[model samples]
Target chain A: MATLDINRVRKSYGSMEVLKEVNISIEDGEFLVLLGPSGCGKSTLLNIIAGLEDITGGDVLIGNRVVNDLPPKDRDIAMVFQSYALYPTMTVRQNIEFGMKIRGISAEERAKATKAAAEMLQMTGLLDRKPSQLSGGQRQRVAMGRAIVRHPELFLFDEPLSNLDAKLRVDMRTEIKRLHQRLGATIVYVTHDQIEAMTLATKVAVMKDGIVQHFGTPQEVYDRPANTYVARFVGSPAMNILRGRLVASDGPVTVAFETSDGEALVSGVPLSPESAARFRDREVLVGIRPEHFTMDTAGAVPLTVDMVEPTGPDTLVVFSAGGADVVARLDPLAISVGTKARFGVKAEKIVLFDPETETRLD
Target chain B: MATKSLARQRAMGQTFIYGVLALLALYYLTPLWVMITTSLKPLDEIYGGSFIGLPQTVTFEAWSKAWSGACIGTECTGLKPYFINSILMVVPAVLLSTGLGALNGYVLTKWRFRGANLVFGMMLFGCFLPYQAVILPMAQVLGKLGLSGTIPGLILVHTLYGICFTSLFFRNYFITIPDELTKAAQIDGAGFFRIFFSIMLPAALPIIVVSCIWQFTQVWNDFLFGVSFTSGSDSPITVALNNIVNVTTGRKQYNVDMASAMIAAIPTLLVYVTAGRYFVRGLTAGAVKG
Candidate 1:
C-alpha cells in the first residue's frame, strides 16, 4: 500500500498562489523526491506533509488516513532539516534521545534507541560532545540519528546535505541511499539538486511555477520528460531544446532544424499516430539529452563547435542550432573548439514537445 | 637615514594619540576626583579650602554617617533598608520583564500570526515614551488596585516599561536563529513550552545575559517611577538617596552627601566594571549575521 497520498493540494498566501492543485502518492518503502528550482512550492509541499504548513485545499493521507489536521507529532514522521537543526546545547546522545524522552518513553527504551541509532550512523564516539564541537559531516550524522531513533513510519529530508561542501555532499548522498535501503522506510525528500534527485529517488517529481511538471521514475523523467521544463531541469548541462518543423509523421517522425553550418535532420520516435498526423509540417521542439549525441563522420547534422568543456570522463561540445546553444557530451578526444563536428541523435532518444505550450505533443 | 626619520615620525604619532586620550580621561575624571577628595575632607576644611584641593586632614566621619545616621525627612534610619528594597524590586522586575519579553519575542519571530510585526511595533512604541508621560494614568491604576505606595507597585511600573526594550533585544537576536530549529522541534513532537525550554532558550544564552543586564541597569537606575509611586520605607534606594541629598535639614553636609552618592553609585558601577565586556557584546550581538 502507498504510505502517502497527496490529493489536489493547493496552497496560497493571500492572492499569491504558490502551489496549484498537485497530486502524488508514494508506495511503501519508496524514496519519493520533490525536485525543482526555488519558489516551485517543493518545500511548501514537504512542510504541508509534515503539518508545519497548512494547505489551502485538498487532502493529505498517510497510511489511508487523512492527516490534514494532525500535528507533526501525531503523524508518526521524522524530518532532518537542511540546516540539520540539531539543538545547540545538547550532546549527540541527548539530541537523539530528546524526541523519545518527550513522548514519555522509558529511560531504558530511550537509551537503547539512542545507542542503536548512534552505532547505525557511526557516531558512537561523539555521543558526549555538543553539536558545536562536531565537524559538519558528524553534525549531519547526528541529525539523521535524531530522526532514526524514533522509528517513525516515514522520514522526511529537506535538502539535508545542501550545507556541506562538494565532496562531503556526494559522500552523504551515498550514505543516505544506503540508510534508506537498510531501513526500507518510506521517505519523501525535497531538493533542488538534480544530481541528488537522479541518484537517490525511486520516483522523481519535477516541479515548476507552482505545478508538478512530471512525476515518474528517475529514468522515465530523464529519458521521456513530459515537457521542455522537466527535460531541461533534470539533466546536467540540461537537455538541448531545438526548435524544428515536423517534416514527416508516418512510421518514423523526423524533424529538421537549422545549425550554424546548415540545416540538420533528426529521426525520432513518433508521437501517437493520431497526434503525429496533426503535428506533421508543424513547429515543435525536439528535446535531446547531451549524452544522446554521438560523433560520426557520416552523421546527418553538422555542428560548428563554439566551445569545448572537458569534464574528466567526457567532453561537452557547445554549438548553436536553431538560435539556441546546445551541449553534446562526446569522447574527450573527439572534439575541440572551432572544429566542424557532425553528430547524430539516436531515433529513440528524441522527445517531442509543442513549441507554444512547451508540453509533450502526445 | 630614511629609516631613522620614519621611526621618529611613528613615535611622534603614537605620542600625540596617547596624549589626547590622557587629556580626555582627565577631563572626564576631574569630577570623580573632586567627589573623592570632598568625601575625605573634614567639614571645616571643606568650608575653608579650595574645592579641587586634596584634603589637608582626612576623616571617615561622613562615610559612616551616610551609611547609618543620615536624616531623610524624619527617618535617620539610613539607606540600608532602602538598598534592600531596590534589590528586591529590581530583581523581580528584571526577571519578570525579561522572561515575558523572551516569550513575546519567540512568538513575534517564529510563531508569527497576521499583523505580528504591527503588534511588535506597538510594544516597541512603549520604549520611546518617557515614563513621566504615563505617570498620571499609571498612578491612577495603581491607586485603584491599592498598590500605590508599595515596592511591588514600583516593580510593576518598571516591568511594564522595561518589557518593551527587552522584547526588541530578544526579537532581533531570535530572528537570526533559523526557523528550521523550531520546525525540527515540532517534528520531534515538542509542543510550545517544550521547544522553548529545551531548544530555543538554551541557544539564547547570550541574548538572555544581554537582556538581564539591560533590564537590571534600567530598573536599578530608575528614579521617576520610584519617586512618583512609592515613599518612605517602601521607597527604592534611588528615592531614598535623593531625599538624603536634597532634603538635609541641618547644616549642608557636603562630605556626607558625597559619601551617600558614592554608595548609591557603587552597585551600577560595579556591575559595569565586572560585566562590561558582555554589555557591549549584548548590545551588538545580533546586528551581524550568525
Candidate 2:
C-alpha cells in the first residue's frame, strides 16, 4: 500500500485549463473517491495519478516518491476502466497473465495468480472463456483480475461500474468494497456517480470547476457540506436552499421568513456564538436535507403540498418554502397531494450559508 | 375459411421471394456455365456447337495445353511461369504493403502526431486517384530508377497503390478499438511494440484477412499497370491471359483462351472461398461494431 499526494496539480490543453491548482493527500489504505459531474476534471485527476496523463504544473507523489515523470508502468499502478477494456482476443487466463508476462514473471507464478483471482471472483469456471463470451459483470471481474494480479501499490478505478446494469452495479459496488477491505490497498477512484462515492469512499473529494470543493469523511460531507454545491450534488432529491434572514435575539436565534399563507417565524434555532455575532441581521441561506423534515401540527411554517412521490419505504413531499422548491421525506402513510402540512427541522440539523458566497457558516 | 386464407397468403409470399432469388441466381450463373463448358470442349466441337450449348464430347486437351504449351507470341510456354510470377509479385507486395499500412494505421489512430487527420486525409486522396492518370508519371519515375519493364518494378507499382487502400482498411478498423485498452496495457508494462503485438495485432485478425483478400484481388487483377509497365515473360498472369486470347494467330484457339481465363480467376475465387467469412466481417466491422 502507498499514500497518494496531489500537490497543486494543474492541467491544461492550449489555453483551456481543465484542472486548477488542486491539492489532495490520502493516507495508505484509504479509498479516496473523486466525485463530480462531467467536465469537472475528476477522471483527468485520476489519470494524472496513474501517470497516463501529464500534469501541467504540479507534483504527484506515490509513497513519498515524486512520480511527476514516471510512465504508467513504472508508477506501479493498475487501472480498471469504465469499459472494462479487456483484451478481446485473449481468454480470461491470458488476460490476467498478460501483465505478468510483460514483466517476465514465471509461468508457474502466473498460473497461481490467475487461479487465485478466478476463485476470488467466483469465476473459476470462466477461466477459459474470452471476454466477449462473458457477461458484462464477468468481464469487469476479469479486468479486476488483470489489475490485481500485478499486485501494484495503488488500484485506480475510473467508473468501473458505469457500464453495468443497476442491479449488477450494486453487487459489484459491494464486491469492490469487500475487495478494498480484504486487501487494504490504497485506491483512488474517479466517478461521476455520487452514490458510488458515498458508498465506497473512506474520504470523498467533491470537485467542481477544476477545484476541490470539499474533502472529508462521507458523513461529514453529507451532514455538514462545506458549500451549497456539495450539499446539492451529494444527495438524492438534493438539499433545499431557502433564502431567508436569521433574526438575532438575546433569548434564541429565530429565522423569519415568508410562508405560503403569510409571513411566519420559527424560533429557537440554535447557532454558534461566532455566527450569531457575525450575521445578526443579514440575509443567509439555510440548507435543509429532505430527511431532516418531520410532520408536526405546530411546526416552523405551514406550506401547501404540490405533489407527493411515493417511493415505497418513504414518500417525498414537494412544497414551496421561501420561494424555493423544498422537498421533505415524510412518512409514506402521512403524505397526500394537496394537503396543508407543517414541516419542522431541529436547530442543529439546519446548516446556514452566506447567500452571496454560498459557503457554510459556523 | 379466413384462417386458411391467411395461411395461404403467407405461403404465397414465401414462394414469391424464393422464385425471384432463384431467377437471380440462374441469371448470374449463365456466363459461368458458358465459360466452363466452352473451356472443356474441343475446338472442332466448339465451332460445331452453339456458344450457349454444353459440350457433348468432353476432353482435357484445352486444360493440359493451357497449363503446358499454349503460345503467347510464339513462346509456346504455358501460363505456369506467368502464374508463378504473379504469385511471387503478389506475395511480397501484399506482405510489405499490409505491414506498412498496419504500422501507419496504428500510428495515425493511436499515437497521433500534430495534424494527423490532415496527413490521413492526404494519404486517403491517393486511393481515389485514377491509375490511368498515374501510368505516365509512374513510367517516367520507374525509368529514372532503372526498374522499367521488370517484375520488381510491377511489384513496386502495386505496393504503392495497395498501401492507401490497406491503410484505409486498417485505420477504420483500429478506430473501432477503444483507447482505454491501450492505456490499460500501458499500465501493465507493455511498451509500444509489445502492446501492438500482444493486444492490437491479435484482435486484428478479421481486418487482416479483409486487407489481404482486397490486396490479393487488386494486385492479381491489375492488367493496366502490368501491360503498361512490362511485356513478354515479365508480364503478370492477367497480361499473359490477355496476350494468349488476342494473339491473332492462324485460327483463334477459343478453348485455350477460355481455359487460361478460368485459370487466372481461380486464385481469387479460392481466396474468397477460404476467407469469405472474415471478408464480410472486415467490410462491415467498422460500420457496426458489437
Candidate 3:
C-alpha cells in the first residue's frame, strides 16, 4: 500500500509561479526519478514531498495518508542529500542511530540497527570515524546507511551521487540500484542527469519549469515520449527533432523532410487515417532517436557528415538535417567527416509532433 | 665563490630583519618593564631614583600590600574583593551573551522568516552603538529596576552590548553551515532545540570559543560601563584599579599603583595567551571553499 501521490501541486514564490498544476504518482516500491535541469522545480517538488517546504496548493499523500501538515519527522520518510549532510561531529554509527535515538529507541535496538545498516553498506570499519575522515564515496555510503537504518516506507534522494567522480558515480549508482532491489523500498530520486534517470528509475517524471513533462516507465518514456520536450530531455545526444511536412499517400501517411543532400521520406508513422488526414499537407515536427538511423548504401536519404566523434565503442555522426544539427549514433568505422553517406530511417520508429504545440501526434 | 656570497647575503638579510624585530619588541616591552621593576622596588628605592633600573632592595611588601592592603577611596580592602566582583560579573555576562548570540545566529541563518534580515540589521546596528550613548538611558532603567550601582547592573549592560558583536561573529560563521544539515536533522525527527543542541552547537565549538574569548576580554576590560554603573565596594577591578591609582596620598605610592594595575590586567592577558590560536582559526574557518 506504500505509494506517493502529488495531486495538483502548485507552488510559487511571490508573483513568479515556479510550479503550475503538476501531478505525479508512483506505486509501492517504484523508483520515481524527478528529472530536469536546474531551477526546473524538480527539487522543489521533492522538498514538498519530504515536507521540508510548504506546498502552496494541493496535497501530498504518502502511504494513503495526506502529509500536507505533518512535519518532516512525522512524515515517516528518510532523505539522502547531495551534500550527504552527515553530522560533522558525529561518528558514522552515531549519525545512523541519531533518528532512532531522537525517538527514544532502546540503546540495544539502536546498536543493532546501526550495525546492520553499516554491514549492509560495508562500512562497519568506518563506524567510529568522523565525517571529516571519510572520502567522498565513503561519505555517500554513510549517508545511504543513515537513511537505511530508519527503515522508512519512503526514501527520498536529492541527487545523492552528483558529488562523486564519474567512476565512483557509476559504482554508487549500481550500489543504489542493488539497495533498492534488496530493500524493495519506494524511492523518489531527483537528478538532472538523464542517464541516472534512465538507469535507476522504475518510473521517470521529466519536468520543465515546474510542470511534469512526461511520466512513465523508463522504457515507455524512451520508446514513446509524451512531447518534444520529454523526447529530447530523456535521451542522451537527445532525440533529434526535425521540422518536416506530412504527405497523404495512397497507402499510409509519410513524413517528408530534407537532409543535407536532398529530400527524404519516412512512411509507417503510427498515426490513424483520420488523424493523418488533418496533418496532411501541413508542416509537422518529426522526432527520431539518434540510434534509429541505419547506415544503408541504397537508402532513402543522403546525409553529408560534417563531424565524427568516436567515443570508443560507438561513433557519433553529426550532420545538418531537418534544419538542425542532428546527431546519429553509429558503429565505429561506419562513417567519417566530410563524407556524404546514405542512411535509412526505420519508418516504424518515426514520431510526429505538432509544430505549434510540440506535442507527439497519436 | 658565488654560493659563498649568496649565503653571506642571506645571513646579512636575516640579521637586519631580526635587528628591527628586537628593537620593536624592546620598544613595546619598555612600559611593562618599568611597571614590573617599579612594582618590585621599595618605596624608598623608587624615591631614591632607581626607577627604571633593578631595585636597590627587592621586596614582597608592595606586592602583598597591593593585593591585600591598598586602599581605594576610604575602602581599606584591596583589589582582591573587586577582582572577585569582576569575575562574578564577567563570567555570567560572557556566558549569557555568547549563548544568546549563538541562538540568534542559528535562527537568523537556518530558521529564516520574514523580516529576519531587518532583525539582523538592527542587531548589527547595535554593534556600532557607542557605550556612552546608552549610559544615560541604561542608568535610568537600572535605577527604575532598583539595580543601579550594582554588579548585576554592570553585567546586564555588558551582556546587552556584547550580544551585538558576538551575534555578528556567530551569524557569519553559522551562515557557512549548509541549510541542508538542519533540514536533514528535522527529517530525523529532531525538534528545534534538539537539532540546535546536537547538530548546531557541536559544530559551533570553534565559533563558541571565539565568542567566549571576545566577550570575556571585552567585558573584563570594560571601564566605562564598569565605572559609570557601579560605585564604591561594588565596583569592578578596572574601577578599583582606577581608584587605587588616583587616591593620591601625601606622597604617591607608585609601587602600589603599578602592582594593582598589573593584577587587574593579568586575567585578560591569560585569556588571550590561552585561546589566542582559536580566535584566528575561527575567523578563517568559514572561508573554506564550499
lDDT of 3 by residue, A285-313 (tens): 99889888888888777889999999988
lDDT-superior candidate, 1 or 3: 3
TM-score of chain A considered alone, across all candidate predictions:
0.97, 0.97, 0.97
- Considering every candidate listed, which one attains the maximal TM-score? 3
Whole-model lDDT per candidate: 0.89, 0.89, 0.91
In terms of docking quality, how is candidate 3 classified? Answer: high
Clashes (N, CA, C under 3 Å) per candidate: 0, 0, 0
In model 2, what is the error at residue A84, expressed in angstroms? Answer: 0.7
Which residue runs does candidate 2 get wrong by more than 4 Å?
A249-252, A267-278, A331-333, B1-24
At residue A109, candidate 2 shows an lDDT of 91
Each candidate's interface RMSD (Å, one decimal) is: 0.6, 0.6, 0.5
Evaluated at residue B165, the lDDT of candidate 3 is: 90
User: Which candidate number has the best DockQ?
Assistant: 3
Docking class of 1: high
Clashing pairs in 1: none
Best candidate (score: lDDT): 3
